[model samples]
Target: MEEIFDDPTNEHRKQELGGKDPSPPELLKKIEQLKVELVQKEEKLLEIDLLYEHVSRLTDKIRTAAESGRHNTLLLAKRTNELQKKIKDRTQKMMALTAELSMRQALAIKLQQEMRDKEHFLMVVSSRMDQGLPLPQETESEWLKILRNEKIRSEAAEARARHAAEEAAATAAGGVCSAAQRRPAVYIPDSDYSLPLPRPYGALAPFKPPEPSSHMRHYRKPIIKPTEI
Candidate 1:
């Protein structure tokens, strides 16, 4: 057991001595590797700082562009509203004008139709006049002819009545007297009527008067005496 313990102690001392004793070239190489690793780490930290700054600048530019777009959009909306109002006003005015035109056209058509009706009526009247139609009256032409014949017969009756009246007046007067008082009554004959008896002139002669006085004989014309002057 004493020999085993002495062997372990010796082995431990040898390892310690070996670990403490290092080569100069090996230490120098290890220090150079450590410096290279430190430099690489510093370079990676700088790249990260630069990337963060680039991202911040891009975000600022995007925010500014969005603000400007909003302003432009508001202006476009205002202009579109104004244009819509103008379009509506013009459309209403056009509709009113169209309605007025339609009314005028209707009135013109009505007047034209009335004129056409009047012209047609005139044409029909003229055509009827050209057909030799008689004027309207209470009696027709044949009835008028009958009335005219009755009027002519009435005229003849009036003439006969007048003749009868004249004959009555003559009969109411004194009878016609003859020159001779002793002669028989004689009637003169008319060519168109029956004759009565005729009397001789001697039987119809009046009686002679006595001689006139000297004053009455002086008023009468003297008889011419055929003597030698």
Candidate 2:
């Protein structure tokens, strides 16, 4: 059993091939080789430590960059939201202004039609009077209503002209007017239109009132004469 367990090559070499223990030179060579391997292991350990430190520095830089990115991202999101809110508000204001403009245009068209019809009616009445025909009775209520409408329109036009002039003066002076201006509201007799006045919107110019027609030149006097009597 001992023979089986023992190394066969070493003993057989000593007996048959006359092999001996390694020489001093061979032993020294092996020791030197082992020392070289030890130095290589030390250098490899030092390199690993340097690489570890470098990796730690890189990780720290990446972490700082990531934190800065997060802060910047939050700031950007907040600014973007504020800008969007402003845009939404402006959009709503623009839509409201557009609706107001359409309403004003419709009102103007209706007023123009009424003016044309009144002009035609006045022409007929004037012709009848010129021919010495029987005149219709003057309507006090109707005349009062017409005067009220004309006064309102005139006031509104004046207001708009003043506003434009003030704006222009303010511009030339590089400042704005702080004066609170009042707008004229249409007061229809027994109607619910008394508050919402027309704003000074349109070109940067004074509002010019329509020119008085020749037929309308003698209209107010006849109506007033009848009312006084």
Candidate 3:
């Protein structure tokens, strides 16, 4: 039985050996071709490395360009800011000058108004004089008399006013005088209150108070009461 199994195995081995194709020379040729392909592949890898180096240099140039562009942009922004500041400053100065000009214009207008008022007053006076109206009693002689009277009256008035004002000032400044001491015994006449009356023909007559009516005039006739008789 062993010989029978061994016989089939030997026969199968013989058939496999007979059917197998010889491949040693083909494998050697394939190995030599693979070595050539590997050499070409190594050359391609070297070319790829050089391309990578060129790409790196190009990337660095791009980075430099980007940085330069950023710097230029920053410089432009700074210049814009400075220009804006200058414009703002100029605008403020213009506003200040405009305000000053407005103030000056207002002052000029006020002065013009004052001048117009003065001119109007003068014109009114001249027109009244031209209309043959009686002028105010301020003639040279009358004025001289008025001035002399005013000088005397003013001297007296100033003395009284000064005394009163000084007393008031002293009281207000914490003077030691009592109330009774503060007031002095003095008598003033009603006649002393008289002011110079203007003539009826004078220009200032229109401004004076109306004279008393005839019915309102005072008389010295005595009243006869029964008890007095």
Candidate 4:
């Protein structure tokens, strides 16, 4: 076991391979070589430190740029969301305004139609008055008062005409009726009707048939022809 542990070279040769008891010249040469290696190691350590410092500065710059990019992206996303919300609000407002405009337009059309109908009614009333037709039944209104006045004027004119006709008849039959104490009877002739008399002023306007809608036009009552018995 001792032999297995021991070196194969002699003590003198071992001294040249850095043994504890080395020769003076050998020791001096080894020391010089070690000193050279130490100097080289120091130079390598300085180069490594400089490389590490450069790498650290580059890493710091990259980290700062990444953080700035992240902040910018977050800001951009927030602005995009705000713009979307504003657009949504504007779209809703536009829709509401459009609906309101449509409703107002419909109301205006209805009001115009009512006004036209009222104007037409007034025209009919005036035409009826010009034609000596009785006015329609209505509440106590300005048109009703005008119609009453017209009726009174017409009755008064008819009364005057009757009185004139009676006077003419009496003058013609005066001699014949001289023996009779009673007044002479007068007769007036009319082609289409009896003598003109003051009729009661209780008549209404002439009836006007209503225009039928498309749906009701097809269901009208048919006229029956007269048949011989």
Candidate 5:
């Protein structure tokens, strides 16, 4: 009994039993109660350990999720910066292209105007030449020489026709009608009239003189003078 009380493990039991040795039946029942209480205390300790493990796992998961969220946010910010830079570069390129296009368009318009001016100059030159007008500060070109020769030829032809007509009139007034004058007269054809000469794209027809009519022909009649006085 002294040994039992001296042990620290039985001290609380000794106090509860009033420092007396318990009867066999009471000891048995007390031993059974102590065993049940020990089991209950061990079960409570096991439940506390399980709850701590669950809380530790949840804390680790929350920490990992926070780190991942921060990393993703950084990545999104970096991508946004890169996209903004690319957009700025693309916008500058577009502006350059637009300026180049405008310059090209202006150049094209200027070229077109120059072409129109050249065409107008050519038209004026062609029209002047066709009208037989004199050129500015006339140089002695081949075309000019040809034109002068044609004018001279035309004047000569007109003078010859006038002379022939005068001669026929003088002959008729002197009262001489010839058999040649009585012949059938050929009339001038409409196609023989003078017209503006065409450019030298084709063969140029030679100038033709007008034909004399048979009515213009006259014979000299012999006059009988009085017997030699």
Candidate 6:
């Protein structure tokens, strides 16, 4: 590098006397100039190192936040599935109720159809890609809201189904209609409930370190200065 920084053309027969050595004073002056340049280069390198360290810290924080959000989403997905299963169990019980044949033959056909539809809901609402992709907080919040609405709805639906089941039990026993006035509300599947998707296990993927850049090939961690000359 020092040779390259030297004069290119001959000013005082330097080209013809190329084999001759420089004077002692000239050599010292050249060494001083190189020292100055080295100091400037080192200062620039220091600035770059500080920048890389700052960038690395920020990147790590961002990834940690993303992982946390994804974990929360997985928990939400699990809770929602539990609620769905609860509702499905209640639906099955309601469908199994033995109503009076004369009054419920047509209703039996409808319940059977709904039961088949309920069978299709054995899975969950979350997509499997959640294994690799980070879930947004806003999306998690929306899911929470959906679950709250479903919770309220399931309570109402459960009450209706339980009442119907009791009525059928009474009819099976040949008991006269007890009045809370003899009609029981039927459970209808809510269209707002998303169709079931294949459920995926929520597990963190194994971490693989990123490849180092040309300048960073020597270091493994967040930062390490290059070897000095």
* Candidate number achieving the greatest TM-score relative to the actual structure: 2
**Model 4: number of backbone collisions:** 0
lDDT minimum window of 10 residues, candidate 3: 180-189
Q: What TM-score, computed on C-alpha atoms, does each candidate reach? A: 0.39, 0.46, 0.42, 0.36, 0.37, 0.31
Kindly report which residue stretches of model 4 are placed more than 4 angstroms away from their true locations once superposed: 1-58, 137-229
lDDT for position 195 in model 4: 59
**What do the candidate models score in CA lDDT, each in turn?**
0.77, 0.83, 0.79, 0.81, 0.80, 0.75
The list of candidate 1 runs beyond 4 A from truth reads 1-38, 125-229
Candidate 1 has its poorest 10 consecutive residues by lDDT at: 176-185
- The residue pairs that clash in candidate 2, if any, are none
Give the CA lDDT, 0 to 100, for residue 205 in model 6. Answer: 30
| Alpha-carbon RMSD of each model | 42.9, 25.5, 18.1, 24.1, 28.3, 44.5
Tens-digit lDDT track for model 4 on 114-209? Answer: 999989988998899899988876723767799999999999999989867777787888733233345224333444766575343334433455
Q: What lDDT is obtained when candidate 5 is compared to the true structure?
A: 0.80
Which of candidates 2 and 4 reaches a greater TM-score?
2
Model 6 agreement with the true structure over 27-146: per-residue lDDT tens digits: 999999999999999999999999999999999999999999999999999999999999999888776674445358888788999888656432222332445554556657888999
Q: Write the per-residue lDDT of candidate 5 for residues 33-123, one digit (tens) a residue.
A: 9999999999999999999999999999999999999999999999999999999999999999999999999999999999999798678
- How many clashing residue pairs, candidate 2? 0
Tens-place lDDT per residue, model 3, 28-137, is 99999999999999999999999999999999999999999999999999999999999999999999999999999999999999999979867876887899876465
| Model 6: lowest-lDDT 10 consecutive positions | 121-130
Residue 44 lDDT, candidate 6, scale 0-100: 93
Which portions of model 3 miss their true places by more than 4 Å?
1-22, 134-229
